[model samples]
Target: MSAAEFDWNLATVWETIAEELPDAPAQIQGERTFTWADFERRANGVARTLLDGRASRDDRVTQYLRNSPEYLEVSHAAFKIGIPAINSNYRYRDEELRYLWEDADVTAVVFHGSFTATVGALRDRVPRVRQWIHVDDGTQPCPEWAIPYEQAAAASAERVRAPWGRGGDDLFLLYTGGTTGMPKGVMWRAADMLRQVNDVSTVHYALEDGAEGIRRDLRGPGQAHISGSPYMHGTGYFGATMAMHGGGCVVSLTAPGFDAAELLDSIDRYRVASLAISGEVFAKRIVDALAAEPGRWDSSTIRNVLTSGGMLGEQSKRALLEHWPAAAILDGFSSSEGFGMGWSLATKDSIPETGRFAPGPNVWVLDEHEQPVEPGSGVIGKLVVRNRLPMGYYKDPDKTARTFREINGVRTSVPGDHGIIHPDGTIQLMGRDSLCITSGGEKIFTEEVEGVILDHEAVTDVLVVGVPDPQWGQSVAAVVSVEPGAAPTAAELIGHVKARLAGYKAPKHVVFVESVPRSPNGKADYPAARALAEAQRQPVA
Candidate 1:
């Protein structure tokens, strides 16, 4: 098909790649490597199984697995079958998982065996889930109710063509970090997503030329890009998609936890051209490893190192360059709803500040009156993006309307990021709004943690805030007041919150004050509370 005839569906592009470069590596994980041919055939088989199980067009498929080939394979299968694949955080406890799946109205689930026990406990609760496909990790057996992923992959090899067919209008649901009450699913249309990817991507896809554009880029064995972030997050998933669009190999680390050595080994083993990470969290760890044992890993192949979801400080970027000067460190400032908002690039010659970024072409800062903030005006405004945006939150019109609004007659996505536009047109991002705390790239809502902390009998009032940290960009700190006779250790309060929410959302530091600082009107005095916590905060060590 010609580029003009191409509708920009992800499945079409991937199918074309399979035909053009069947032997090229599509994905790699240690001993396992999936060629483009293998990727297509397996995705076809999974799609066929979903069809046989009565999965319908635009049905939601939740990926409950970690960083692995199955994650993308399932997404590929969903695209072919006109289904919207949903990402389920692997860190989510039972309640969070329940809330996410229910909110997304997930119809099918592809999970790893490690989560079999957890799924087994909640299976009866979510009856809408008709198909349960389990990927084996050798830790637990696939339950009787769940279909083995391998079995599904071996079911059929024919290309999946749903009765309703597929198009650019197909949806891809990405759930945001639950900052308010619960996480909301950001619905992205395949066409908009494709255009957005093309807008920022080095390789351009000619909509007029159709599949030939993909064939044109099929120049040698594709580049190998390593993603260290969890696939459930935007940084990892989008990075994988961007790599695949270039017919590049997406390499994943198999280490259950973040292991700097494993990442370095993977880079050397795969000759990785790009390494995508989540800000200074991973960069610091990588630097520390290189510092501890210099000249240990041969990292000459990496030409680009990208960070998103958090800031990569100048110090961390410079440290990384010391080890691999050939690599250019790229830091992106974006959110689940807004991609290509702002970015900063660092090389041996130049390294920008941590939170400073070059504004994306369509990005603008708007003041309270919705007027564009003048450059160098010293005014903080809501960062907004104009084109190639999402279709809004799934099933939540109110939030969708609020987040995706018309600004000065143009549709814009205002995801609540505040920033200042410098005189040079660069952006100095302040952060996400006041209530949200970004720790190691995870957005934790103070209200969410505070509500959980308040559930404890000993705690009468609580206010959660973010404190600066060397490793995590910020750590969750809780300032609390207890009942007059009650005395609770910080661990007890932390454990109480951890039991209800994800461990990352739990307070890393706790400050026990006589009373939580509140204003005359009973509103929280966040500034004073932050000061108190900063002074008395004790790490949970």
Candidate 2:
């Protein structure tokens, strides 16, 4: 496919790559590596099987696997047949899992062995889900009700054609972050998303030469990247896809969850070029691991540390730099709904301000009235994208209408983030507007307070929220997890925030827990933390 004739669907680019670099390594997990040709063959088999099983275009298939190569295999297969693959959070319980499956109206499930119990329990609940494909990771027994993944994947190796031609119109459902509420599926057209997420057909590579340009760029020594976030989430999955598209290797975790040492080992073993982490939790854990034993892993191969899905606080960036000074730390500000908007780059010589970004050229800041916020005004407005955006939230027409609305005659994605577009064209991200705490008519972004508190030496992890106060209406409450060998008092932590930010922004109450509640992917669980914060505190004025 030439750059001029490139199809924007996910399958087309993948096919172009597979045909060009048939023997190049595509997916890497520990000692195992599958070449582009091998991965495509497996995907072909899955596609043929699914098509034979009466799976139609745009049918939703839920993937409940852990971080593994099966994720890409199934996702690729689904995309080939024009099916929208729905990523299920592996950390979800029975109810949560049922809710997503029911919401997506999942026709089939591809789950890991570890989740057999949950899948089995949900089998009767979601009776419409007739197809169950189980992956045997040696963790648990393959349920009798399900077909072994290998058996299904080996059904056919032929390229299954989608009767309905694949295009940018193919749906890709990415469930948005549900820190405070149930997650919403952000539906994206493959073509639109390809252009939005990655400038593939455009100026990135020499599209004029097509496959030749691809071969020239991607034929060399592989640039390996390991996504340290959940495959079920946008950050990791998209990173994996992007890496694969570049003809680099996508490395998955050996263990089910975050193991700092294990991650370092993979980086050392594979000579990984980049590492994608979600936020501070991942950075802190890695920093702690490296700080504990600096010589444990040789991290020289890593050139870029990519952070997205959540904020990578300034202090954590510094800590990460202290360990891997050679890497360029990039903190991308994006959401499931929005495409590329802004990013912060930190090198050894320069550490970017936390939450500040080099805004994309298409970025915009719109006030509540839908008017553009004037540059240099230092006014906080809703961060929005004037560029091409996602289709909308799946099934939720109300939310779809609200999030993807016309701003200045261009359809936009306002993912509820607040920011100020500075005079220099840079964007200063405040935080999510949905989580903004209003106290006595003062709007305080929880991220600002949390960032300051996290800078303290005694703090490990923290989430700031608003607890009801009689006088202030809602006072800041810091739910923190202190570092070992240090017991920072509530007043001391409060002082930490006050020293950095305004006194009014400091948490009036502190709830020190064993650990902050988080999704398996280490993303914050604001609802759980808010509940904990609200439980113990008495009425305050």
Candidate whose TM-score is highest: 2
Clash totals for all candidate models = 8, 1
Regions of candidate 2 where Cα sits further than 4 Å from its true position: 1-8, 200-203, 206-221, 537-541
* Model 1 CA deviation exceeding 4 Å by range: 1-6, 178-180, 434-535, 538-541
Encode model 2's per-residue lDDT on 44-64: one tens digit a residue: 877776665566674678889
Among all windows of ten consecutive residues in candidate 2, which has the lowest summed lDDT?
200-209
Q: What C-alpha lDDT do the candidate models reach, one value each? A: 0.81, 0.79
User: Looking at candidate 1, what is the lDDT of residue 32?
Assistant: 95
For model 1, what is the error of residue 500's alpha carbon versus the real structure, in angstroms, after optimal superposition? 39
Per-candidate TM-score against the hidden true structure = 0.82, 0.93
Over 1-541, each residue of candidate 1 has an lDDT whose tens digit, in order, gives 6533456478887899899889999999889999999999999999888886465774788999889999999989988888788989877789989999998888889999999999998899898889999999888998899999999998787888989888888887888753345678898987777777666555666766677766876565568998888778877787788888778899988887778999998888888888788764576678778888887788999887778765455666777898888988888878778888888999998988656789988898999999999999978788999877888988989989989999888999998888778899998766557578889997776655665676576765677889899999999899887767898999998889779778999999899988677521123557788899899887887
Predicted structure 2, TM vs. truth: 0.93
